[model samples]
Target: MMVPCALHALWRTLLPVSCFINSVLAAYDEPQGRVATAMTLDPTPGKDAGPALPEAFVSYAFEFSSFPDFAGNSTSGPNLFSDQLLNNIGNITGTKPYIRAGGNTQDYAVYDPSLPVALVGVIDPERQPNYPTNVTVGPSFFESYATWPGARYVHGFNLARSNGTYGDEDLLGPVEPACRALGIDDRLLYWEVGNEVDVYNRGRFAVRPPGWDEADYVAEWLNATRRVRARMGEACPELATDERFKLWAPSYGGTDNGLDAVRPWQDGIDADGNVVEVSMHFYMSGYGLPGITLQGTLLNHTNTAARLAPHLNVSRALAAAAPGVPYALTEVNSLYNAGQPDVSNVFGAALWTLDFNLWCAANGVARVHMQQGLNFRYASWQPRDTGLAPKGTRPPYYGDVAVASAVGDLTRAEVRVRSLRMESETDAASVPSGRGEPLP
Candidate 1:
């Protein structure tokens, strides 16, 4: 049976970057489709029914890590809380809501690591499983989007020896409370340990702490999952439900994401358990946006997705090695240019987003999170100068989905695009190494 995919993961990897362009252009010779009818993309806000989504999907993401920092400013306004972010989310993806936290932020924080975690919403971290930060950020985000009809969540916990597990624990501190806050604790989809630990010190990534080993990760994860198991055992007494927890890892880039090179954390959960999901990330392009006409942008894109296939394949294979646990590309994106208005705002970026998501669903990806949709920020390629949101709309804005809604629905059709590519003789190095560090 061909099980349909929700979405495929997208991320920027050090693929055998194909610079050839003229040869890879996709043949849009099918006599324009309904979407291509407008001169430019008519992404302008058009009524409430926006467009039907391809599938009942979850808009995976890492959009809310920062809060508006306007302290004591009596601007005498609504003080843009979580609602502002959720407002746009509901207005956009009008179906099953899916979201993840921890985009380009550290898992551990300034709080004391030695003491028991003091979570705001969920009572005990052990009982709850994966809870992040406090209610201020988590609740704010949840409250904003939770009412989105049928929303679900994937929480990435903190892991690092300095605080919980230098690269262990799958660091599930703040996950529980966040789920409780969302009121979907029972359906608390999946959780990840940290962001791309494979490409350490590369892009927007921090260094692995002292004594960070693969075994250490498995051990810490064992301890944390035990708590979750204990909680599950305790649940039957109160009307029985398996709302415990699942394991996820490496949170970034499909290739290494740290699990493959490092020892697999197959400590607990037998081989047949559908409970845990070994998570990773995926992205494309070095933060800078790629340009491809309907008849262009093939070699680079295809090679980019293919290059990371090994990594994704490794991730999928982990399910076999550490059976029972499913595989997932938790964090993904076409580029790291989150807030960069130029690259992220172009129709090109929008196109990339659609293609990447479709790719994830078609490939073996279990789930995908598009960094942070709420708090869009410029990534490595954006230098220090770039706007947050685009002044006007072109692509990568809200309307990027009209196509996603279309393509995401056509899950059965094997996407076959013939592109015209002008190949660049150089390799991945041909693209300038941007500022952001590659993920660990």
Candidate 2:
């Protein structure tokens, strides 16, 4: 069956790798000895297909504590390399990529006004060396938001530290300052309350007591979000209205994890009717997993499809529950835990990224945010020099650039993407075969 997808015409010159562009249909043919197939394109939109997505459909999510390092504060000046890279994509797509300044660290963060720097973090090497396990952001932390001009953002709040008790103020403390900072330039897209709360009840990452299910999560979420809205109303009154006070919610780790991604919605997690998007996280494979290979894991189309099936199911359920609310892979990349070394950092990873993102657009997913951090093996680019890695553009950044160029100039026309069925597990394509009619 042909499904509705959204992507634009491809610019072959911008792609560093071999990607064949035939009219509006763009196909990433694998190297010789892989798979080859002929595919047809249907220009007619499917009955169930949604509208074309935004120009910046494939954006980014920076690790929370790394925001200052990636964007740089007013004092340090914006990271010129970061700006140049993002600008390259914007130049192709006609919209600067939206940034999600949140991740696991967002939940662990605490606002410390007395602190002089933008961020102060403590990384527990045993727990996770890539990101800080405990983090504090000072008043200057908000200054990083203004550094990346024309880039919109979804700022996350500290939901994990709140206990939902009558007097608990941890979750409410950052709302005022956050809203005030975002309100100044209208760069705020939506507020996210937490990150992967579903796993807070299990493993070494456990924070909530055992047996904490969907009900408890929903209640806490409602209480915290309501408080957040109330504080935002006081701090940035213009953004607190029904039209503006929206969130990207239920940012679960996966669909079949500690908590089902669909249950939170069924439990009225968005009881306030302010959840603008149903967001979730995904990792193709975990770092250090046995038998992982570039072609077998990251570059394999069949494996990618199998891994994404659950998220697609959850997206369908979310569509039924929240009608118009979009589904986004707010945090996603090839491998979790900062990625596997050789497999994730190679040129093959760029191919995987191009295939992965186009596949998402074809399957009705509204947006895909490639998650990254400093020195991360799978990161598109290292924002700063670290002990482990130097600051420079990586292979995956080229993949991001290719995807942006493929989905060109959304301001001019409404483009729809469709996947070309391949006979082999290695092949993938996003065909937009005909000239799209101009938007009214």
Mind sharing the TM-score for model 2? Answer: 0.88
Instruction: For residues 1-440, write the lDDT of model 1, one tens digit per residue.
Output: 01112221221111110111111222222224523211121222223211222332325565334311210012222224333433344444443435565544434332233333221232234432222333223323333333333445555544433233343323433444444544443445555555455544343334554445555555554555455444434433221134444545545355544434325444433322434556666655433455522212322344445655676567556756765544556655555544344545454455455444444544545444555443343221111122443222234433234323433332332221111112221211111211111211
TM-score of each: 0.56, 0.88
Residue 54 shift from truth in candidate 1, angstroms: 11
Taken over the whole model, the C-alpha lDDT of each candidate is 0.39, 0.77
- Cα RMSD (angstroms) for every candidate in the order listed: 12.0, 6.1
Best by lDDT: 2
Residue lDDT tens for model 2, 32-124: 364344445445545433457666887999999988899998889989889889888888778888899999999889887788999889999
Q: Which regions of candidate 2 are displaced past 4 Å?
A: 1-51, 164-167, 423-426, 429-440
Task: Candidate 2: give the clashing pairs.
Answer: 5-417, 24-432
User: How far out, in Å, is residue 335 in model 2?
Assistant: 0.4
Best-performing candidate as measured by TM-score: 2
